[model samples]
Target: TKKALIIGSGIAGIAAAIRLAVKGFDVEVFEGNSYPGGKLSEIQLGEYRFDAGPSLFTLPEQVDAVFQLAGKEPKEYFAYDKLDVTCQYFWEDGTSLKAYADLNRFAKEVQSKLGEAELSIHEALRQSAFIYNSLAPLFMNRSLHRFDTWTNPLALKSYLRMGKLGIFSTMNEANQKQFTHPKLIQLFNRYATYNGSNPYETPATLNIIPHLEFNIGAFFPKKGMHDITQSLFKLSEELGVNYHFGQKVERVLVEAGVAKGIRAKGEDHYADLVVNNMDMVNAYKTILKDQRQPKLLLKQAKSSSALIFYWGVKRDFPELDLHNIFFSDNYPLEFEHIFKRGTIYEDPTIYLNITSTHKNDDAPAGCMNWFTMINVPNNQGQDWDQMIAEAKRNIIHKLNRILKTDVESLIEVEEILDPRTIESKTSSAQGALYGNSSNNKFAAFLRHANYSSSIKNLYFCGGSVHPGGGIPLCLLSAKIMTEMVEG
Candidate 1:
């Protein structure tokens, strides 16, 4: 059997291993951490259990597809429930909205609360669906670097509607044009943060993000998000894939532009093919140091990182659900602080996710596990210690004002994940949540390809590579990467 070596046990790496195993290859996974799952792992804070990364779950069919590909019933191994209320939004002005999974219901909610016409919501979603349907085939499901992709009939069809695809405008511009209410526009513009980009700068083609939540629907894993990694890791092992924990891969062994294997723990392990699930920039800088680098792709602006405070709250509020967002008073200025000023905004938009809302066991009987986070600039030698301290004060102040409770007093335990720790823990380049910001329209094309252009048999997958970040896209990155591998 051909041997395959996967560097990193992230969701994408595990998925790639499963793919290779199904193709009858002997696969070995090397992870620096003691456990599998890079960002999609879990953490425990006293009596509270938090999904340490990527709290929101969507595109569940992508997870099911992997199990089905292995000829197993997905539900038997994994399961999740679609969220009826995808997210509850709160503004400082006492305005609140529930983003219902049903389009018509959500439209009604927007109209009733924000005073925007239901038709505006309907029209925005329709445009979102149109963009998603048109672009997914060309930009996502396949490799943008491949000539065959552009020549596909779907690509040709998409070309005919390029002008309508929102590529020319910013996400903010598109939202402003779509809605009259400032709050509604802000709500739609927030979707740009889904991939760690600024709505004010990211191309409006990202408007497709709303379709994933409002149209296809958002979901929550029956367990927590970490189950996504655990289940896939189990499946890979069941398929005879081996895993080496605490084995930090030092370098990719390449001879005459062909990948031989990798070096880890002072020994060389050879394989027929190699897959890199490390951040693309880190892979190029560390593992593939001897190889020619894709300078332009690596030089693109890094995506915004996150400052997460995992708190075990002593109290639970019924108003908040699985996902909730507290809007900042000045959205544009907030992004400006993150992207341009390289600092945290005083009134930053806060995303508070409590898995305990769905899985009662995640917290104590009357408590909750709060995964509170805010967008921040990726590590660039900024004073993180000062920033984290100030951000925490701001977060507590905002929560206290909006929830009408003393947030600082409610925290029974606390754990913080900042840009510095995120980089140290996950090996994401400068701790970027997504590899590169989609601030420019060409960012989709600028992302590193799944397969190395110069090195034969060396492949890349994960949030850092093609298809962009988030769970679904990382899975797609693996699919796209492995498709180029030969059995």
Candidate 2:
């Protein structure tokens, strides 16, 4: 049997392992951490359990398909339910909106609350769906660098409808043109940050993000977000994939410009193919030391990082849901601080995720676990200690003012994850959430392809490589990488 060695045990790595195993390759996954799930891991703070990263769940079918591909029923291994209320949005001006799962109901709610025309909402959604349908087949499912991708029928169709994608305008510009209401514009512009890009600079093609949440619908796993990692890891094991914990890969063994295997803890493990699930920048800088590095690709602008505060609250609020966003009074200035100033905005847009609302066992009785996060620039030698302290103060103040509660006093437990720590934990260069920012139109074509052009039997799968970040894209990266390998 052909042997395949995987470098990390993230969702993408595990998915790749399963795919390769199904393809008749003997698979072994080496994880630096003692446990599986790099960013998708969980944390225990006192009596509260928090999903350490990626709180929002969308495109669950991406996960379900993995198990189904392995000849198993997805529900039997993992299950999730579509969320009725996707998110609760709060503005600083005492205005709130509940984004209902139903399209018509959400439009009516927007009309009644924001005084925006219901027709505008419907039209925007229609356009978003169109962009997703047109571009996803070419840009997301296939390798952008490959000539066959552009020559395919799907690519031909996408090229014909390219004008509707808004590739020429920025997200903010397109949104401002679409809606007269500042709040509605801000709401749509927020999608740029989904890939950690500034709304003012990122191409409006990112507007397709809203369709995934509002149209396809957001979902929550039955057990919790961490269950996604657990279920996939379980499936990989059942498919006869081996896992090595606490094993840090020190080098990618290259012989005559071909990937031979990996050197971990002073021992070389040979394989027929090597898949790096680590950050693309780190993989080049740290592991593939002697090989020719792609300096331009590594030097691309990184996506924004996050400062997350996991607070075990003493009490739960009735108004809060699984996902909630507190909008800043100045949206443009907030992005300016992150992207340009390389600092966090004082009045930052806050995202609060409470898993205890759905899974009662996540926190102790009458209490809740809050994963409060704010977008900040990727690490660039800033004074993070001072920045973290100040950002925490602002976040508490904003939450207190909007929720009508003394937030600081209710914190029974606290743990913070900043960009510095995120980098250290996940080996993500600059602690970027996504590999690179989609701030420019060429970002789609600029992402590193799944297979190495120069090295044979070498591949990459994860947020740092092709497709992009988030759960759905990472899963697709694995699928794309495995397809490249099979060919």
Query: Which pairs, if any, clash in model 2?
Result: none
Task: Give me the runs in candidate 2 sitting further than 4 Å from their true place.
Answer: none
- For 302-349, candidate 2 gives per-residue lDDT tens digits of 999999999999997999999999999999999999999999999999
Model 1 over residues 90-180: C-alpha lDDT tens digits? 9999999999999899999998997889999899999999999999978889998889998989999999999999999999999999999
lDDT of 2 at 301: 94
Scored by lDDT, model 1 comes in at 0.94
Q: At residue 483, what lDDT does model 1 achieve?
A: 86
Candidate 2 lDDT (Cα, whole model)? 0.93
lDDT values, one for every candidate: 0.94, 0.93
Candidate 2 C-alpha error for residue 186, in Å: 0.8
